[model samples]
Target: MTHFDVMRRLTGPLAALMVVALAGCSAGSREGDPIPAPSTSSTAPTPSTVPAVPPAPTVAPTATLPPPPLDPLTPRPSGANTPKVVNVTGTVTAGVESGCLLLEGYLLVNAPTSLVYEGVRVKATLEVRPDLVSTCQQGTPAMITSAQRL
Candidate 1:
């Protein structure tokens, strides 16, 4: 064949192959690549470009009963006289300081070791004893006369 005839035949096939290869590469890149965000003069991000976040689920309000009154009683003049006592019923919880127990804001004192555990509901007879020295560092100190799990 003449030089011109050979050149023309080669160019047509080579151009068609190049176009096919470029189309395939462009399609793959379009699928894999993330779209570039539009540039803005303002530093603040555009609201449209930001993703929408779902709102948190609403929780129901819990009803809380008021804590019982813990008024201190008058100290007995003599050991022969009986001290005043009040009954308190509530759940036992751990104090912020270690080895301390509390019931309805009353620092439990003179309670049995077995009953000093946390989270146990109990019916207890307490005597407000503000005169006694305490190291529990929390709640009104009350002496437990009798206690039983409820």
Candidate 2:
């Protein structure tokens, strides 16, 4: 127990096992070379190096509407004009030349003539024929008589 205390306990456990084996051989060397292994598998995710998140922005589709136009004195039924007189040219939004006879009210051509120029808004049995409502003149160009169309 004394060859100098067993050479100082074998040089302090051989200098702590040569400083833990030179700190695990200087953590895998550069000065001692050798450390490259690591790659065990698992990678796949590269649609072009992946990191472009921009494919969720594009929406513009919705349009559908058209249907409304039909009204020209609405009254057909009873042989609906069974080959009778039904001229109907259309234009005179509302005339009234009453001294002899003229009372017109057309607008049945392309239809929708904004309610045929007010003869007090028509209807009263279509102004009860004051000789065809006087002669109905607001613009001019009629030919009327029944000529239904509604």
Candidate 3:
């Protein structure tokens, strides 16, 4: 027989012998053998023997007051129909975004073309409009109600 045929003949017997040897190694308690009890130490208690702890009591949530605004502008009187107008005095500077002007951290909207130039010192009256949509991302959005060069 060729070497390949010889190998094929031995492969089945070799595999069967290996399986039998592995089965013998894995064999544990035989028939009629008494089962061994679980080992225990007196120093440490078993999980089932330990007593359960009582759960913590639940707490009711309390109402909290809202925080005050951070802006320095005067607070509006309670129940006012109009937003509070604020006066800002500072040099008008170009914002990081194009077509945006800032004065004292307030982005100027509807500002006159003359007052929109950079480095122009001006006194401007503004109404803070947090609801207004703006492309000036660097400062708070405020509408320029009035402005004058100083």
lDDT tens digits, residue span 1-150, model 3: 899999999999999999998996677556665864445656777899899998998988687775554343455568755766899999989999898988999888777886556899998899887656677787888878888898
Residue lDDT tens for model 1, 32-90: 46764446568876999889999999998799875444333434446533555789889
**Where is model 2 poorest over a 10-residue stretch in terms of lDDT?**
124-133
Instruction: Please give the distance, in angstroms, between residue 41's alpha carbon in candidate 3 and its true position after superposition.
Output: 70
Compute the lDDT of residue 81 as modeled in candidate 1. 34
Off by over 4 Å in 2: 2-4, 11-13, 20-22, 37-150
The order of the candidates by lDDT, greatest first, is: 3, 1, 2
RMSD of each: 16.8, 23.4, 7.8
Clashing pairs in 1: none
lDDT to native, each model: 0.78, 0.41, 0.80
Instruction: Report model 3's TM-score to 2 decimal places.
Output: 0.46
lDDT per residue (tens digit) for residues 1-150 in model 2: 669988888999999999999998667544445775446686988699889877997878687664332233554356532322334333233233432212243322222345343232333112122112223243322233332323
